[model samples]
Target: MDLHYEVLGQGKPIVMIHGGGADSRDWPYLAPLLAKHYKVITFDSRGCGQSPSQTEAANYIMDVLNLLNHLSIEKTVIIGHSIGGQIATEFALSYPQYLQELVLVAPALAGFVHSLDLLESFQAIQSAAPDVSKMTELVVNSPFCSVIKDSTHSKLMRVMTEHNIRKMFEWAAFGAVWPKPPAIERLHEISTRTLFIRGTRDHEDSVKIETHFRAVPNIQFVAVAGGDHMLNLTHPEELYMNIVTFLGEPNKQA
Candidate 1:
């Protein structure tokens, strides 16, 4: 299925993929900042936003390939967040020749899964027949406690709950199948220049991702101080600057 995506600014391409339960709009704050230096593209993965869903389970690798093929993009940089980051890592592993650079934000990787609350939550969703509504609430509320900062936490929680509940449920169900991608053994195999970003205050998995990719010769890790998993939304300008620096591009023109 052809996914719906928005393109902004003009320059080398940088595709932004959102996490599960999130649409292209998840990058609204981040995309515009990057658009200043590179052509920024954000898309809703299949089964969410304006895209039509295929019967196949929502596989991150499939979505990445399809999006690249759909855009006829032979080469580009990719900035993936959360589950989207998992997809990006797989894509880089499978198609290293096509990537110019990779930026993983709060990426989920092998052994990054938490045992307590996070796994239990996902397990509950996976074992059951899928309750889109409950999952929606769960996802929206999951990050609130981690935000640390009161105002940002409250605002994001409200936005996620009120504006994208139904879409969130659909995304939750789509993501219910399969475990997060494994990148531990494959990190060294990835030749593409990579940058991994994590919020210092994010869940344990976020820090684990940083440590996982640290051994890779081509990867760099940047921790967003006082930031949460929602760094793209919470610190768009700074995130964009770091991405541009990794790509060896000039900062966006003010």
Candidate 2:
């Protein structure tokens, strides 16, 4: 599959992966800021945006590995959001040697059975297939609300709430379907440094997942106050600075 990808800047590589439902366009605003420090690459995952998936079940980790191999990037810092975070986590577990660091933003690391409520909401929206306006209304007015202010909420919803493909949406729900990684059980197996960022008021599952990673031997978790699930959009400056600081931190002594 020919996945659509964009690269910016030049230096150590950083691959930015977007959450489910939304595509790589989710990174346009934030990727440029990160590019100032390192090479930044963002792309639509298969089945979303410009990339189309031929198989009913898309294995995103393979696509990610292929993308990196195609670019000849031997090592990278993977910065991923939501479902992309899941892909990144599994990638780190399966190929820890290829990653310098793993940075997750409001990741969906909690188990699929645990995230059933989120799944159900997504399913409800998929079943309804609401247009942009209606989906925007639901995003702005729902209890699952996380975006900070009306203006920011409107802006993000405007950008993300457009796709209404039910099959793809269900595919995302299933894509999100996985038992929590044994990474939780074998966090020490990962030698790469890891960073977990979450909104203080993000969904309950996110908070729990962040807490779980806190015990990972080489990981740190930072909570952004007054931020929501989509902290990159709601509080980009805060998120950006935290990432910079983490990336700049000294390596652990052997």
Candidate 3:
């Protein structure tokens, strides 16, 4: 209930979870478009944007469930990007009855081991520590994110990354809590229809993640040409279209 959330046009509910180092601000171009068709809910996950930093171990999956309960949303479609996608995946596996559909964009897997290159890049940023400027630069220039470098939204991406990085300093040392065994081990357990989307210009790891998602019973894959990990910001229209088709919803001009 303490999370900062926004609600858009009314219809079947659609929860939008932004990626790590990002908040709902990434959806300015996509939410309204999706809102035209269904009620869109966007929120700042704990320790990001306006959401409060956690003193206790963070359970992102529970945070999501609490948000849905607080809003009285019993069942809804979930659209998550990057780390957000990981959370959505676990939630769908743990509480399949609460989901109608799922959409993942350049998602990080729950149990899959990420590349050493990625782990080192993340560590480098953290090593920069309280040097907010250096952390922001490292993140913006990181391979998984370099796709945003030339876009007009690069400044926006930088600002959001900086905001989330600064908030990290306020969080406790406690690590985030995820479901047991992890979603990667249970991809076959997913019951809702799923749409997996990754950009052509994204990192090599994203390409690898796609191969793992083949276990899902009802799922579709999309490769966005020229899109990157930040597709929510750079390719909202494309994301929206793919989501519409996957959900079997009418394609509005949005």
Candidate 4:
């Protein structure tokens, strides 16, 4: 298949979507813990990890839909990080009937325009381009990610970042297609039981997005103390605990 995925454990299903510049490998530390309590599914989105690149326009929300249908997962919790969180948000908005809960960790807003400074920083990273090491350094060494720079997960983060950068060189003609009207303006429309998470050391722009998400009618927000954008790697135990608490009773398949 074009998307490489794996399922573990046995309980209510939870589909974990990794952020940009990462793949299912992003969930190694946290996935196992979650697997102990729920059926966990992790996958490499197109062009990341083992997934093949696509030449046509891609709708990640649809990708999530197709994955669920292929697995015969009629209902599942969606936990998404970074860009993956953005996809999860749109998915919840589009198909609330299919999700038991929605969790977003530092997700990007579909219609949001980042500040000029952040845009420039991203551009600078892109300018490094073919220099994979430099681009990876720019991403990992940034303030929002620096907490992991000295942690044991640093090596893994570097590897994932570099692998993601290299994958860009292999991209075919592909354009991401997000649903219209943007999730930012439609936050009030989402009625799913939602959990929003972010780290204390997260970027300023992420804070702005949180303000928009407050419009979500039924949502809870948690700030991981001393956590960074990559809290999943640096604070998996804490992350898992918060999730389980939010999930409450273990899901049962009747």
Candidate 5:
């Protein structure tokens, strides 16, 4: 599938992958800033935004690989948020030769087991089969919404969440089969330079994911003081600076 994507600027390539409930629009605030220094590619993952939905579970890694191959991009930096981060990690493991570096923002790791209560709560939400309004409200109240101080960005997030909630559910129904074999045990296999960024206000799972990545030889972890899961929207400047600094490091050269 030729997923929807847009590329901007001119320089070394940098691919930005949005979170589970978001699309390419999620990077609007940050992409242009990064574009000043590098080519930025943003895309809607399978079943999100402008991309066609699939009846079967989507292989995010393959979808990303397909996109890169379609553009004839052999190697580039991969920046991903939430589940997107999980995809980046898998790509680094499965196709390390194709990555220059990996940047994960409040990433979700495979096999980081959720509590039974949390699982039950998600099941309940799934059972309720929320309408867009209900899902928007739930998302607004979730940790993902915390620490978002900008009203305009917050509204944009709500709108995007409502727009993509149905597809999110559709993907969920297909089951959580992504990042197969789990990434926790495969961290050491990732040789690509990596940067893991977590917000202080983000969920505990992000912290756990960061902890596991510590064992990876080429990984660097940074915590944003008051940032949250949506740092690309809420703290784009800070995130951009961190990314730019990492990309500029002498050791990160392709």
Candidate 6:
């Protein structure tokens, strides 16, 4: 599927991918900071924001590659959040030639066994299908909001939640159809410079996934103090600084 994307500035390219229930807008506070040093691209993944709904699951990886191909970006830095981070990991594994560097913010890895409570929460949300108001409420109260200390950031998240609730539910329902192999064992295969960032207060599953990458030689992990799953929104400055520093390193580029 052709994605809705925006390209800004010039120099080494940086592609930003948002997590589930979000779109390109998630980078408004950070993209510009990075754009000052490199060309930056942000887009709505398939079935989110302005992008069209998708029938097939796990097509996000390809959709991102296709977007790069469409823009003639052969090699660039890739930054992904949550599920977007999962796609970036898959992309690095599948097409290492196209990456310059990788930054995963609270990325969700494939094959990491989720806790029963987490699974149950998801099932509960799924079972409450078509209840947009309830879903919106649940999302607003989710761990995604834990680190949103700023009122402005809180409002922004709420707005995004309202806008994407229906589509979020739709995407969640398609999850059962796209089971992927575990990526933990393949981390060593990724030679690209990769940085993993997670919040101190983020979900347990997200925090725990970092442990699996401890043995991966090319990965660097950092924890944001007092941050949450929505660190990009709640702590954009710190996130932006870490990204700029990582990408700016002379020897880090692939």
In order, the Cα lDDT scores of the candidates are 0.72, 0.73, 0.90, 0.89, 0.82, 0.79
The C-alpha stretches of model 4 lying farther than 4 A from their native spots are 251-254
Better of 4 and 6 by TM-score: 4
Which pairs of residues clash in candidate 4, taking residues 3 or more apart in a chain or in different chains? Answer: none
**Per-model TM-score on C-alpha atoms:** 0.83, 0.84, 0.96, 0.96, 0.91, 0.90
lDDT of 3: 0.90
| Inter-residue clash pairs, candidate 2 | none
lDDT of 1: 0.72
Mind giving the per-residue lDDT tens digits that candidate 4 earns over 51-140?
887677777888899999999999999999999999999999999999999999988889989888778778888899799999999888
lDDT of 5 at 141: 61
lDDT of 2 by residue, 142-246 (tens): 444555435444565555546524325434334423324545665566677989998887788887777667666788888999777777777778888888888
Model 5, 1-254: lDDT tens digits are 46999999878899999997789988988999988878889999888898887667678888899999998999899999988998898889899889988999888888778656546656655565666687676666665557763445788888887888866666634644565578988888889999999888876666867888897898888899888778788888889999989899423442
lDDT for each residue of candidate 3 in 1-254, tens digit (9 for 90 to 100): 99999999988889999999889897989999989889999999988899999888889999999999999998999998999999999999988888989999999998888789988999999899899999999998888876787888889999999998888888885589998898888999898999999999998899888999999999999999898889788898998898888887544422
lDDT of 1 by residue, 48-150 (tens): 6677654556666766777788878889999888878877887888888789888998877754556487777766655543555565455555642366335
TM-score between model 1 and native: 0.83
Candidate 2 regions exceeding 4 Å error are: 110-112, 115-119, 130-144, 164-188, 249-254
Candidate 1 weakest ten by summed lDDT? 172-181
Best by lDDT: 3
Ranking by lDDT: 3, 4, 5, 6, 2, 1
> In model 4, what is the error at residue 230, expressed in angstroms?
0.4
**Cα-based lDDT at residue 166, candidate 4:** 91
TM-score of 4: 0.96
lDDT of 6 by residue, 104-189 (tens): 99998877788887777667766776887676666666655566734468777767766777676556335422224557778778
- Clash totals in order: 0, 0, 0, 0, 0, 0
Name every residue pair that clashes in candidate 5.
none
Candidate 3, position 52, lDDT: 91
